[model samples]
Target chain A: MAINPLPPGAGTAIGIDGLIALLAKLPGLGPRSARRAVLQLIKKRESLMQPLARALAEVADSIRICSTCGNVDVQDPCAICRDPKRDAGLICVVEDVSDLWALDRAGLFRGRYHVLGGTLSALDGIGPDDLNIGPLVDRVRKGDIREVILALNATVDGQTTAHYITDRLGALNVDVTALAHGLPVGGELDYLDDGTLAAAMKARRKF
Target chain B: MAINPLPPGAGTAIGIDGLIALLAKLPGLGPRSARRAVLQLIKKRESLMQPLARALAEVADSIRICSTCGNVDVQDPCAICRDPKRDAGLICVVEDVSDLWALDRAGLFRGRYHVLGGTLSALDGIGPDDLNIGPLVDRVRKGDIREVILALNATVDGQTTAHYITDRLGALNVDVTALAHGLPVGGELDYLDDGTLAAAMKARRKF
Candidate 1:
């Protein structure tokens, strides 16, 4: 849908509309929902919008990709990567930061993470260079890393990416594990319940 | 849920978590949906966020309330009121801007608007001073306005607000009409299908 232009200030051309537009690009939103959201934000601007705007401005200013794991972070190395309490030897490789966050929410995985920006997609021409595979290989090559957890989604592309990473990490002589095949085929890691995720982690087998 | 703080440049301290927190305040959104939306925004930042940020900044800079119609506008009189083509003699009174926009989208009413901002709510301590009833009555008295359409929402508070305005406008000797009771109980004008709104308008009786 096209945004109708009005004489700037005399019409609805403002932050609220832009916020709604941005929100509409999300997975499960449309123009109507977006409009409703914007109106709500305006009605509660002081408590909601200001905090949101400040948060947005802050994120736009300081967000950076983690140098170690490629997770979105304020620092080069994300908190999970820098934490000494985490098991650095066991790196759970996930497709995106959201997946990493999901694993963190479970509070079961005390291991470090290797966020592969995205899965290997032949149709999309994504290859080893496009992901953090090189760094993952290097981290394993250091000989300190032991078990590498492949926590990719259950899609075909995800499986392909998992196999490719498995093969690469294989050459490094580290134990490779996939997070169980019973993770409901074609499901996203983010959609899995905590119990299911924990079960999958528990039932993980050597790939 | 607690917001996970990021290190320097992981984005901002508030970063995506901050954005999610802000978005969670919107109507019909909770923390889970907010997180999903924020992730989607970050993924499509180039295509969606850049333009959205510009729109937000622009709107944030210029948005204001239309002094005459009580509609949110960048100007005092608003485009609909200032437009010479729109029937200045016919004024459509609405409880909120959404109602005005809904009527405008129907493309049937070529009349000016009188936005009440909200309906009277005794529980919320809203009275005549809280709405634009005074200005609406004043407009009817000063302008050549003939028909005043009472397009208030079909709620107890909405009816109270409409009656209050109708009583005030009655003094100006204008023909006051309300959209018919064809609207569903507790239904918002914005949710009515276009045809229903049009039919309701055509079947409107005197208030």
Candidate 2:
């Protein structure tokens, strides 16, 4: 997304070129890779390319921001928010939909989610008002929520945003917790940083 | 394109998941990268995602394989084939449209192109009939073509296809040429292969 992915004479004018330009904007694909992707699409139009086009169209028209939880889905409240099995009283807060997908994919959480869209960052001028924090706090204030888990990234911006959200929901009579920071699963101890080593040692429990 | 790029429980059922699966089939994007791309798309639906969907639709509806030169474009004859500025008497034959694009991007060739679709490969079960070889020969038989330059890749399959095309058009009143083999521009001599070194030595000429 940072680099110009269009060729010498290519732009958004031609449909093929436009597709290439748009594909180039996606993460991990530069202009050359986009061109290769487009060529492969063209080569396999029936099996891959046309199907992808239809899928993109369908998602574009159907995918919506969940009014309750901020997850992008075909429904207003989202599939997770609508699910009867998921615990509505427990909400896992995340910085983005990507984070939501990651947590969901892992099958680590059985509760609903509240996507903040992004962490609060002064450098990028991202504030509380810009995110979906108000809706989250309102959901908690409506009173069924028993606990809020801060599943944000362990970065400065992530911690800052988590602290701010904690303060906002301080008077709501809900328990606020955070994900434990330690060596990740399958992580090599020798390759880990000092901070992680320290955290892992401090959080070590009896076997 | 080799690896199945999706995580567990992600597939072509849900719109977002479908988009991710389709994107994963692209050359470089796998399931995880596809998820990241889809998430990024969802995050910027208006500026990027929706536009990409629209472009894909437009291309799907408008793109046509050129009947004359086998190029994929908006026109049947293709823009290059229709252009009067290029030398119609000369044709550069390539294995695929991507090869054509690469050559065209260089701005080195002033003639039109003939895309073979693919080279003849016994391992892949590809024959001369599988490619657009007959059309190439037919084009030469029509008598306007003065020279047919084989610009296929410098692989065994490429050479075999080129030789097959040359033999097919041997009885015709046209000259068949091929791309010279030597050290590529900006390619270091120290890193060159023995075959390439031998070829470069054999093909050496006055500087």
lDDT of each: 0.76, 0.87
Q: Fnat of the models, one by one?
A: 0.41, 0.59
lDDT at residue A39 of model 1 (Cα atoms): 69
Q: State the displacement of the C-alpha of residue B59, model 1, in Å, after optimal TM-score superposition.
A: 2.1
Could you give candidate 2's per-residue lDDT for residues B1-207 as a string of tens digits? 133343322332567777888899999999999999988887788899888878887777777888989998865667787666799999999999999999998999989999999999999999989999999888998859999999999999999999999899999998999999999999999999999999999999999
- Which parts of model 1 are misplaced by more than 4 Å? A1-20, A123-125, A181-207, B1-13, B122-125, B183-207
Q: What global local distance difference test value does model 2 have? A: 0.87
**Residue A53 lDDT in candidate 1:** 57
Error of 2 at A172 (Å): 2.8
RMSD of each: 7.3, 6.8
Query: Model 1 in CAPRI terms: which quality?
Result: acceptable
Per residue, candidate 1 scores C-alpha lDDT tens digits across B71-105 of: 76555566666676788899899988888878987
